[model samples]
Target: MATLLHQITIDAPASRIWEMLTSRLGLQAWWDGTVSIAGGDCWRLSSDDLESPVTLKVVEEEPDKSLEWLCVQGDPDWENTLVLWTLEKAKRGFTIRLEHRDWRLSEIDLAAENTRWGERLMKLRLQCHHNDDLPVNDDDLSVWT
Candidate 1:
C-alpha cells in the first residue's frame, strides 16, 4: 500500500475550514467537480475530469479537527482508498494536512496523483482566503478544464 501526503497552512479559522470540508456548498466552491450528497454520510462527486462519479463515504468526522472518507466507488485504483484531512490551529490560521492512503502501488501513477492533490489543496487555500479577485494562471486553470 502507498500513501501520499500534502500539507498547507492557510490564514483562516478552523471552523471555516471545517465547514469547507463538511458542507457540500463549501466543497463545491473549492473542489473541481459537481458535489452532491448521495445519501447518508456519502457524497457523490462528478466532474468532466473524472471517468465516472466517485462516491466517498464519511467514516470519521471530528468537528474543526479532522475528517476521513473511504472511497467506496470510483476507479478501480481508487477503490478502498482512504482520504483523510486533519486541521491544526495555527497562530495566524490553520495548517491543513491531507493524506490519500491505502493505494495499490502497481495501480496508480503516484506522481500525477500527488500533483493533483497538491493543486486541489492550493485551490482550497485560495477559496478560504476569499481570493475571487486574484488571477489564476492559465497553467492552473488547465488542470481542471
Candidate 2:
C-alpha cells in the first residue's frame, strides 16, 4: 500500500476552494474532464486520458474544512482507493493538503500517478486564482497524452 501526498497554498478562501472541490461546475472548471452527478453523493468523472469513467463516492465532507472520496469503480487499480482534501486557513490564503491513499503498489506506477495528481492540483490552484486562460484541456506538462 502507498499514499500520495501533495500540498499547495492557494490565494483564496476556504469556502471558494470548497466549492471548487465539491461542485460539478467548479470541478469541470479545473479538472481535465467532464464531471457529472452519479446521484447520492457520487460523481462520475470521465476524461479522454482515462479508459473509463471513475465513480467517486463522497465518504466525508466538512464545509470549508475537508472532503474525502472513495473510488468505487473504474480502473481496478483505483478501486477502493481514497482521495482526500484538507483545507486550512493561512495568513495569506488557504493551504490545501491532498492525499490519494490505499493504492496497490504492484498495480500502479507511482511516479506517473504522482505527476498526474500534481498537475491536477496545479489546475485547482490556478482555477481558484480565477486564471482566465485555464488549461482545462491543455496538457502543458504533456503528461495526459
Candidate 3:
C-alpha cells in the first residue's frame, strides 16, 4: 500500500480557508457539488458532469484547520478512500495539505491526482484572494464549510 501526499500554500488566511472547508457552497466549489456533510452519513458525492451517485462519509472535522472524509466507505481501492485536508498557519499565508492515504495502483495515478489538485489549490487561492466564488475548476473544490 502506498500513500499519496500533496501540499499547497494558499495566499488566504486560515480562518478564511476554514469557512470554505465547512460550508456547503464552499465544499461544492472545489470538492464537487455532491456533498452533504451536515446531512449525515452516506452523503451523496456525484459530480454535476458525471452520471454516478457517490457515497462518502465525514469521518472527522476540526475547526478552521482540518476535515477528513472516507470515500466509498473508506475503501482505498474504491477510489474515494481517506481524504484529509489540513490547514497550517504561516507567516504570510497558510499551507493546505491534502492527503489520500491508500494503496495506489500506480505512481502515475498518484502524480496525476496531485497535479490536478495542485492546479485546484492554486485556483482556490486565486478565488479566495479575489473574494470571489467562481472557482472555474471542474471539481469545484468548495462544497461545504
Best by TM-score: 2
On lDDT, the stronger of 1 and 2 is: 2
lDDT scores of the candidates, listed in order: 0.80, 0.81, 0.64
Per-residue alpha-carbon lDDT of model 2 for 38-86, expressed as tens digits? Answer: 7757888888766788999998887889889999999777889999999
- What is the C-alpha lDDT profile of model 3 across 3-108, one tens digit per residue? 6677877777777787666555565566644665424444555554334555566778777788887776422344556778898887778888987776455877
Provide the lowest-lDDT 10-residue window in model 1. Answer: 136-145
lDDT over C-alpha atoms for residue 143 of model 3: 39
True-vs-predicted CA distance for residue 80, candidate 1, Å = 0.4
Q: Tell me how far the alpha carbon of residue 139 in candidate 1 is from the true structure, in angstroms, after superposition.
A: 34
- Candidate maximizing lDDT: 2
Error of 1 at 120 (Å): 0.4
Give per-model CA RMSD: 7.6, 7.3, 5.4
TM-score of each: 0.85, 0.86, 0.71
Comparison by TM-score, 1 against 2, better one: 2
Clash totals for all models, in order? 0, 0, 21
